[model samples]
Target: MKVAYWPGCVSRGFTPELHGSMALVGPRLDLEMVELNRANCCGAGVIAEHNQELVDTLNARTFALAQQTGASMMNICSTCQGAQSECQQRLDADDAYREHINTHLEPEGLRYEKGGDWSNKNLLWLLVEEIGLDKLRERVVRPLDGLRVAPFYGCYIVRPTGRLGYDRFPHRDKYLEHVIETVGGTAVEYAGSHKCCGFPVITMAKATSLRQAGRHLADAIDADADCLVTPCPLCHLNLDLQQPDAAKYVERDLNIPVLHLPQMLGLAFGLDPKELGMDKHVVKTRDVQRKVAELAAA
Candidate 1:
């Protein structure tokens, strides 16, 4: 399936492993990613606080770029997916609003036309909807049989059901668990799986963000999960990159490995850990790697 792939700022900059892992695994799944290189940021809901119109205009331009590719839009970042989807919903519903946004695009000769077959979805949605779980299971060369993986669905991807397609995909909440099971990993159900990783408020409330991250990590550990997998790079940034700081806040040694969803799939596809950028994570994935390796060797 061909898609106008939008590697959001977080994946492209903050967590390159997430982006790299997707690059390595996308072709294996026959997902042709036509990157929207010229596209600008989706604002990730941060910019919207100051200027909602500006955010919509920026996203409309991105949609226009995706339209030029003549393929459906796909985002790796949950923040980007939510921001774009929200804007797309507005544009689709309000004709006058879309026309007003198009005026800004006129300078660049780009206009986003709604009511087409074109759609916007995140990588998780693509894996479950476009590439069926049954098909994905068949492609697993290295089954994660002994691994207990926890699924973390950060706010944007699953919430606001109307924009994120949760209403249409009623069982979408379990999609991550299905993928984990398909890869032969035990899905560890935890309370923090669907909560925020606190990335949105990190800049303003660092301590609160760290506490939230610590809570999620502790929840996963308490649930006996070997590792946590998240579709959102921002969540990974907080859960993995800031884990040590979070430990200080929570008063515990939280060393759980957080994997980007693609990295988990890459491992199941028999791709090397280094190839999937697993070694680059802040919270070392060595334990998860060794466990998977031992299981594969058995």
Candidate 2:
């Protein structure tokens, strides 16, 4: 199962372990993860608001690189997945836009044709749809038996409607839960699971963003969850990096640890939490690690 892997901007610099854990866990799942050398930021789904053309050209080139690999483009970040997938869909449907994009690509010795034999696939979809839950369960040597996980989908991953193929029913909210249970963790449903982590509004309205992230954490805490797990890097930033701010706004101590989906998966695959970058989190993960240790004993 070879695919061109794009960690996007945030995961490369902010949460590198997301990709690192994937690299470690890929072979266990027979996943051949190939990095995209020519890929740039998928505009983080923000540049489109200011310059749609730049976003389109930027993503078209990324798809072009994935095309070279003769495999689908696999994205770790939800915003990157949505942005690039949206661009691919537009390029395939719009001829004039495709010509315009190709004109820009021509200078760099790259060409994009409509209805090309390439596509973008989200990493979560690759796991659930392609890899299968039973297969993933088989690799879980360290089952998260006693841990209670709150699955946060954030926004853009299963949203904005009518874009990605994974937007179908039964998966929009349940995919994360399925992955959690596959690793032997109990999935807790809270108000935060389907809510936005408030990354998009972080720059423009910092306070509002913090409050939103705060509410999500509060919900998870209220539900007595052990940790929060998400596939989106921005969500992890809000839920983990900005946790102090979220605590301030919510007027409570929101101390729950947040983990990248891969980090949780890595732990279940029997990799050390430190190796998966768990110790690097703003919120302490030692308790969660200890809990896993306790589960091992039980």
Candidate 3:
């Protein structure tokens, strides 16, 4: 299937591995990821607080760009998905507001018509709903047998059900768990699986952010999970990149490796760890790699 892929700012900059892994996995799953290279940022919710109109305009511009592709828009970042989806929902409901936003795009020759032929869905939704578990299972050349994976949903992707679709399909709450099992990995149940990773408040309250990140890591560790996988790059930043600082806040050495959703899928698809950018992670993924390798060899 063809999709207008929105890599988002974080995936392109902060977490290039997520983008790289997605590139490697998309073709393997028969997905044509036509990147919206000219697309701008989704405001990531920060801009919405300062200027709602600006956020709406920016997202509307992106939607206009996606419309030209003649395919449904798909985001790899949860923040981008939430921000754009929220704006799209509002624009679709209020015709006058959408027209106001379109005025800003008129100069660029772009128009985002509400209730158009295109819709938006994040990578997680596409994987579970569009691709199907049976199709994913068939593509798993190297099953992650004996590996325990903790699913970290973070926020944005699952909440505000009206915009993100949890109200229509409650089963989406278990998408990460289902994907884990499809790749032959045991889904480790933990309290922090659906909780926020504290990325939003990291700048405003450093200590609180650290505590939240540490607690999530601790919960996954306490559950005996081999590694934690998250769909949001911001969550991965808090849980993986900031883990050392978070360990100081919680008074424990929290060194659990955090993998992006695509990276985990790439591993199961028999892709190399380096190709998936596993070595670039702050918390080393060697343990997870070793476990998967041993299982595949056996």
Q: Write the per-residue lDDT of candidate 2 for residues 1-298, one digit (tens) a residue.
A: 8988887888778888787887787788898888996688898777877788888898888877777788877888888877777787788788888989878888887776555446576767778888899999999999999799999986777776677664454465578999999999999988879888888888899889999999999999899899999989989998899999888988999899999988998899888888888888999999999998777767
Question: Which has the higher TM-score value, candidate number 1 or candidate number 2?
Answer: 1
Model 2 lowest lDDT segment of ten: 164-173
Q: Which residue pairs collide in model 3, if any?
A: none
Give lDDT tens digits, candidate 1, residues 124-240.
Answer: 888889888888988999999979999998898878887777778998778899899999999998889889998888889999999999998999999999999999999999999
Off by over 4 Å in 2: 113-117, 166-170
lDDT of 2: 0.84
TM-score of 2: 0.95
Give candidate 1 regions above 4 Å deviation: none
What does the lDDT read for residue 166 in candidate 1?
A: 71
Candidate 3 has what TM-score? 0.98
Candidate 1 has its poorest 10 consecutive residues by lDDT at 158-167
Residue 196's lDDT within candidate 1 is 90
The better candidate by lDDT, 2 or 3, is 3
